[model samples]
Target: MSKNVDYMVAIPARYASTRLAGKPLADVGGAPMIVRVCQKALESSASEVVACVDHELVAQALEPLSRQDSRLTVCMTSQNPRSGTERIAEMLRIRNIDPQTIVVNVQGDEPLITRDHIDEVAALLASSGAQMSTLCNPISSIDDVFDPNCVKVVMDKDNFALYFSRTPIPYERDNFAQGQQAVTELKFKHYHHIGIYGYRAATILDYLQKEPAAIEVAESLEQLRLLHYGMKIAVATTERPPETGVDTAADLERVNRIFASQGK
Candidate 1:
């Protein structure tokens, strides 16, 4: 399991959410969502999982969880980061983390992230030796494949991503006219982006310093900035799509339902 390698998972959480303020500390089932996230990361083969949050209220919310389990480490980061990349960069610098160690940034809102998912990503990053790595799951359903909210990724033969977009890519001009079967056959390997990311400590810092790229601003995907700067992102394919994180009130309600059903 590569226990010898030092790896850490840091969830970059913010208190402000345009859809739901104090989103990080929002309760899911019997636990705050962030606590669930931290628990999953700690379950991985990583050395540690920390919450690098901006607000004191968030810290306070996480405090009870930390007391309940001492494995969770709570740290402070700047509220000024323009992007998640910047926040991770700042956390790496503050901790004086080894540049060669692998750091996984599991989105704070994804309470359903599994321990296996975290470990699988870490293994892919180490095996591929790429600057960065992320997960993608094939879309068999026609609705999800065409859904813009399900960000699609086109990868090369080596599994290095060529581009990512909210648009349905590799457009089969004839398929839409033909109906479901035609669309499904055409998109046999269509993949949806999972927000999970792994980076070499140095690569992350380098990405933060580069100016935002043309595609980055247009697509609103920060990972595009790495591609613009000519960074190689290796992909690991998972068996199924992960549960969506809390974004809107509807998303929260959906997640709550899932958690409640599971008796979590």
Candidate 2:
């Protein structure tokens, strides 16, 4: 792989999740979930993979993986990073990553993250020349459209995000009036935002330095902050249907079941 514009994966292993604390170290099958995330990152075309962790325990959990794969590295960030994006920015600054490189942020909780998706996000950024890039999958079900936790994104004709929301956006007033299950009647396409992201190292640093935008505070989505400030965020679709990320105990159980079946 080429060196400049090389995709560098950074998995933010935030130890404190409101619903599931110590989530990074949580076991899926036999290994820590973050380790599996690192393993996924390793499968990508990324030149390096760094687990940006806050606690020593999370770093310790990733130690074996680091030894096994020379590409794997660990960087400790401030305990109180405002968001995963901030954690990635801190990692770049601390490690002195090249500005021309692209930083791909894969959430530690997503054990099922695939190599294709990570590479696709980086390619989108490189091809589109956008400030950042992320992946989304078409909303196939009514439940996903209405579920607040399932964030919806609206993109322009060029596949750049216009807005992201907890609410069902570009509201299908006529179809929605029928009931929650009426989403199928809508004509417009709805996309479920995948949390994975890619940005040029310098772009992310600039993102972290900006003041929080009002829309971001209102929507509670850090990506909104990027759009609010007129940053171009390119979008790519997942290669296959998206899988559930570990957020709650129930989510972890579901992910474990998939992992077990996959024989991982």
Candidate 3:
């Protein structure tokens, strides 16, 4: 709703995938997954959609489409960055993007990244004056609460994140025994950490300046580093369900099936 909010969407698609090699080019329904992500960003309110990739193959794949859409670009970056945020930072530098530029990070693997959340995050950052903003969804399944890969987050009454972790947060010490009811009860307080993020290009660059915190390395959650440095992260809760990002073969098949069923 904040049309005055200036923002760009960048997808950091690293070719090195520990689980699925060349994940950016992985097929979803009919086209490459990164292409789907790019298309989604293109549909958003952002002024530009840049695909910051690591390999030539990713650049080559995105180049043809970028030529057709001026809003899209393909920039190859060094593969050695610690995380995708670092990769996006490199893109910002290479593109000479202003430090105050608001850039939304739409993960290359999340073809189904929420457009509403993208706008919400950018608006939240602009309105709340937080260094960064991200979206979270209520945990509906017990499987996800205990799933280490599915990071969880707890936010204060002011809607700023208190912490992010793999373990179930705000753990009810006197909750009901395990069952479908308990899962539903946990949903009342627990939230799934959506991987999508929005921040000023300067904010992320400043973040990289800090040394890795013990908590960050311990939890393997990069956002912890920001919180560890006392950066306030605004969180927007959404009813929209979290999409399964492609990582393994099972994940690929699952996303493909979802897209195929939707007649994409």
Candidate 4:
């Protein structure tokens, strides 16, 4: 494995989430969720870690963490951007980041992101030679497979993503009328899409500039924009499923429990 690559983990921390307002700055243990995400990425062998926040209050909350670690670069992006990808693009443009830089988009809500998952997604992009890369863990249980909240991904034989849907895809005909319990015995395979992504600096810029595709609007999936433009997305299978991301108060409690279990 080549460790010399100049990969930068950019965590896009938006403070305006409707589900949990000021979510990125929400307290987890003592430190904020965004800081936890940045620190997790910093654990990886990436060259740099940055928090691309849209609000000044978020930047203020991140200030102390910036002082603690020189690796934490705080960047202010547009507060009105349509998506996380747009915010990252704006930050790259303002900073005049090198086009050669390999940037990874890490969601701020994911406080428990692991280095192994980061390295796995990054390595997939490097080895597959694809413009963009993301990860998904196979769904073993029926509960997660049927939940609409759990976005499912179907991939080609080569592991390139064919489509992403909120609906339970490859719908087992035998289990359609029966329900999740009966589907488990049908020898079916499903996958849940992970929120992390790895892409080149230039590829992201190009993607943001393009118009939103029809499928993207219907499904509310940003990855569809890449696929709509006919860009091949390589899917790397993660050994471990992702930890809970803090989208609501209940989610925060779940993350806190995970941290307590680890004695953090």
**Clashing residue pairs for model 4:** none
Which 10 residues in a row give candidate 1 its minimum summed lDDT? 179-188
Q: Report the number of backbone clashes for model 2.
A: 0
Q: Over the stretch 69-147, how does candidate 3's per-residue lDDT look in tens digits?
A: 9999888899778679899999988989999999889889998876677788789889988888998888877777778
TM-scores for all candidates: the values are 0.92, 0.93, 0.93, 0.94
lDDT of 1 by residue, 1-264 (tens): 545456789899877877898888888887788888888787888887889889888888888878876768888998797666677788888999899989988988999898778887787788887888999988777777778788999899999999999877656567776754565465346888898998889998888778889998998888898899888899988886579889988898899999889988
How far residue 96's Cα lies from its native spot in candidate 4, in Å, is 1.3
| TM-score, cand. 2 vs. native | 0.93
Task: List candidate 2 segments past 4 Å from native.
Answer: 1-5, 178-184
Give the runs in model 3 whose Cα sits over 4 Å from its true position: 176-188
Q: Which ten residues in a row have the lowest lDDT in candidate 2?
A: 1-10
Worst 10 residues of 4 by lDDT: 179-188
Candidate 4 structure lDDT: 0.85
Ranking by lDDT: 2, 3, 4, 1
Instruction: Give the per-residue lDDT of model 2 (tens digit) for 1-264.
Output: 223347789888889888998999899989999998999889988888999999999989888889999999999998878678778888888989899888888988898988888888888888898998998888877787888999999999999998999998879888888778544555678899998888888988887889999988887898988898889999877648458689999999999899889887
lDDT of 3: 0.86
Residue 144 alpha-carbon offset, candidate 2, angstroms: 1.4
